[model samples]
Target: MAILPEPVTLSLICILVMMCVKILMDQTKKNKYHFPPGPRPLPLIGNMHILDIKRQDYTFMELAKTYGTFFTFHFGRAKAVVLIGYEANQEALVKANYDFGDRAPMPIADDFQKNHGVIFSNGETWKITRRFTLSILRDLGMGKRPIEERIINELQYLNALIGSHNGKPFNEKVFYNATPNITFSILFGRRFDYDNPNYKKMIGIIDDVVKLTGQPEAKYYNVFPIIKYFFKTPGLVVKRVNELNEVLHEMFKEAQEAKTEDSFRTYSEAFLQKQEREKATETTEKIFTEKNLLASTFDLMVGGTETTSSTLKWAILLMMKYPDVQKKVHDEIENVIGLERPPKWEDHKVLPYCLAVMHEVQRFGNILQYLPHSTPTDVSFRGYTIPKGTIVVPLFSSVLYDETKWEDPRGFNPNHFLDANGKFLKRDEFFAFSKGRRVCAGETLARMELFMFFTGMLQKFSFTPPPGVKKEDLDLTADPFFIMRPKRYYVIATPTI
Candidate 1:
């Protein structure tokens, strides 16, 4: 009698109807969507169990061997398409372009950037911020004149910082500060003294927060939206991000006070002027607010700092690990610029070996290993239909280490960028900065800084492992995280002078 009551009868009927609808939708998807080939996914957890959680790049490599170049997989219930090898990536992300131009949603990246910057934003918002950013950066000499002078000037401070050690062993702390200060000065219009309490705290917080992102535990939150909402795993990331924001906010406040209406001193003032202009136009919903400015500023700061610094850090570690390579690079630089003065951005013309070494560092460093893109709409890529919003990882590892692309994909070989006559040869397969509309906006600036700072250090000193540590035993293995950074170790920077 209770079961037959009106409420109980209605509940039973509703449940049955909903179940039929779900079954029908599942069947429809099966019949309609022609997803790429891959191993079958299980319910709920999906393909996460099969993945090598710690090193995703390595996992992706192994998966390519099984599923071939383009394969569909899942992180929990969400579908992901992995584009492996040079051709597969170039076709989908490069030639087809805008179809796969959207940024794949990642909770951790959203939280880190607060979803207001160019890296994670889409549509008109992203377009406005990107265009504004490029304009301001160029005006401030980002890839050009005054910027190169700023970098070359910064190298003096960096070289002095290294020389302070008096050939004693030092960790990455000094290198970290030296690299970021160049971008930091450009973004805020002033250089931070390396020992400034606020500066130390900011770098330390970012370094730690970056470590948390690419870890297996935190990456789940990025892939599966459910985990991010239900769990407390992002608390540390949130806290550190807040700390970084506070620091950036203070910088903006300082910049605002210093700026005249007509004179834009830094990235902050240019952005503020845009916000004012947009407000005057009655387009108050524009992305030119302080939040977007800071997000874009933070994007430049974090990205500019991390990639160039990490690559150089890896360069030091690689040179130390392979001393013979170091000697040749040292000898080449000696031949070109000599030890009396430092290396400039323009020195690349003569420093072929040194230039090749930098390229190889980027290639082998593979700092941003797993580059994620997304399909904005249904994209028929290479005879496979990828549904809208599917995550596409253009495996940078595959491009950086493709057997067909590199003569010896496994080793750290600067000769990879060199011809038989020892001329610098640029390889198209080197997708360290990625490709397409999403290619690194700060690329020109990064390249200039990497060449200058790297040669700057090498010109003044030869980096080698600490005494009693054999070059054979020195660990060049990267400390796996959001970026591939050299593991913490001391190196003796013996001055070439």
Candidate 2:
């Protein structure tokens, strides 16, 4: 190679020196907006080793004790700032909601194409789907007579099922099927017989899917997208996804064949009809297509099914533990609506203690741990700069159990929802349905289902602990996932005398 001229060499040296200086400046630039503090992390893996997926709650609670409520953590290369107390949660979730509310598009969820669905979608798609879903739900009888009639029918069938027990020590799980079955019926405009094999398989798939969500390996795949391309072995998460997809496709195919334009037979039909009409007109894109329909229906089935059912299960368990509270609820029902008539939705207004128990059950259950969202654009919050696209997690669980807000945060107490005069009280801080623009779209439907199914069941049966088991023996351990539910156990459902 020929030697460079003196002038050219000087110019080349200047360029290289400038590049070095620029990089040095960038490295030294302080991230003025610091994330919440947490345990010191290692390089590459960050705080990955500290997490125990199977017992995530215990680990996180312990971590909170050491690191305080507001803390920072890292998984792989991604940094997460966790808000752990009521104040931090409220400040981040409500006050600076615009900075927070967007769900992070994790890789495994993206592989399942969940980012397009309302539950997982971010930005414009979420906003549009959320608005449309709420409107359609109202039209399809979420808080209307149609849904009310369905709940009453379900209660009638369950009353008969409980009658069949003949005061024997029957396991409550058998009767619990009615709750999820009714939810499915409302969603698909069809119900599965309790003995149906397909229905059993579907329930099993849903349970597995929920369990896999809290798996460390599954989380690892999300944090590191490249792992999926290279792996040849079938992952547990992949199998769960396949099972869910099959169920969704079958349901959608049936809905499509039965759909009509004039009447709203089902939620899916209403969406399909709208999609067909929209197709005729020139459109930028089709948001109401079959894929979105399938995903949305599946989202509803997942969101509505497990949460309310689990809460009901926990309520029964808690009532068994606190006999005095359960007795008070039963006495109130007897005083307001006699044993001959079933507890109707209208009676909820008059029965203060019963309503408080329901609210307390949901509050104590605390299904969602961290409701994840992402920033649509750059936002400033509490003197910190929240960059665009940063994943903002709303720690709803922390808020529900905050010591300052609750009288006995660690204990299960229905009195938390009661006032000085023994009337049912409602607080804005009770963000179980969440708040702001990204709050749950199915709040009304959830409320209706919880009230109808819960009061209906309580009226017909008395929940009691199994033989040789004390109320204190019941397990309160919750499994970590998208929803936090109690560990599996059997209970005795005895008929009320």
Candidate 3:
């Protein structure tokens, strides 16, 4: 055995002492603060050994059963405070919104967005961009008759495409192409033909981005960012995002050339006008920039398209699974609007059963389990002193599936949104679009699309399982994507008229 030099030996001893002191200080600070209790975590990995990364929402709910609604969960060295149940999520998201409203940083999204967009950005950027977006959407007829007319018109194209199937079994993915056109019309002032190459390319890129974002490898990158050097998913995500940005830039150029001082025709035009105004003003901070335009547009295009389309797909699947419920919707549509006339947004008011079914689909489908939020400052929440920048996840699945809130929490029953007298009963517990200040920016438009598209489809056609497949054989299990998308299945749409 060889002996080390005295200087090197002393240096090694000093390093060990310093590490010990640092650990002691950290433990002391943790003890001083009343942090929420959680399961024991091992060094470096935290609670990853115990967690199911794919179905983290389910794992969080199970842990909540033991640790109560508020608990600390660790992903590697990072700390996340999980808020479960309606009361806890409501209190944090609504009551203490300012304290818990920041978007939690995820490695892949941060790398791509860089805090530029509405969905993942924080502080002033989030506030200004979100406010601007809502205003633009409102001005462009988000909840008004203008948008309703657009949806009704788009329905003609969608009906034609679906009718082309001629009662033959077709993959539900076809809805992806149709549903996004509603969003495109709002964003660019025109809709693309279903077969246009650019339209197909854009949707394909968005779908790839969504699928990659939901993969386990992407989640691992969030926990261990260093893995990006070895992993291909993160790099692929950035490449796809850049491709999307290229498509958006072309539209931006068109919007700039088409801009006018008289009136705002599209979302892109309004944003360009705002960008110019910010540039002209010397004193004010320029919230609207070229990068922001790309980020905001990306957020709107992706967020607006995927979730609405996925929900519509689920609605059709559920209708096929339960023909009795489909019959009720069909009967309601026949009574209110009949077979000859097209279903309008106004018809939803008189169609209570149809309205209930729509709400139930959102609740039962549960496409987005939860989007993580963060604390902007150190704050006391329910007797726990959560530190600043702590990742906070308000588990939406818990609220949606709370046994205390719903009589049939695990079952698919439309009565959850219906009163005994057969009217649409709005439940406060439905967090499908999330809650509070960070609630989905596109909620109103989604409601319009869902009601109009869903009712219109039922009016023209009845959805059923393919030839030999029984309703019981139809799988309700969501695909392993970041969003809870229904797995690929074939549906037969027979024209009722």
Q: What clash count goes with each model?
A: 0, 3, 0
lDDT of 1 by residue, 116-159 (tens): 88788888889888888788778888777788888888889888
Worst 10 contiguous positions by lDDT, candidate 1:
224-233
Error of 1 at 277 (Å): 0.9
What tens digits encode model 2's per-residue C-alpha lDDT throughout 1-497?
A: 99766998999999999999998787754454556677788888877788765544455667888877766667667777676667777777778777777787666556665567678887666777778788877777777777777778777887787677666655545545666675677567787877777677777776777767656555667667677776532266567767877886777678889987687677777787888888998988778877777667767777777777777777877888888888898888777886777666777789888888888888888877765667777766655565576666566767787777899877888889889998889876686887766677777777877777777777777888778889889887676665777766666677675
Q: Which candidate is the best by TM-score?
A: 3
Candidate 2 stretches with Cα past 4 Å from truth are 1-33, 52-69, 170-172, 225-234
**RMSD in angstroms, all models?**
3.7, 3.2, 4.5
For all predicted structures, in order, the TM-scores are 0.93, 0.90, 0.94
Task: Supply the TM-score for candidate 3.
Answer: 0.94
Candidate 2 residue 195 C-alpha distance from true site, Å: 2.2
lDDT of 3 by residue, 144-203 (tens): 899888888888889888899988999998777666887888788889998888788889
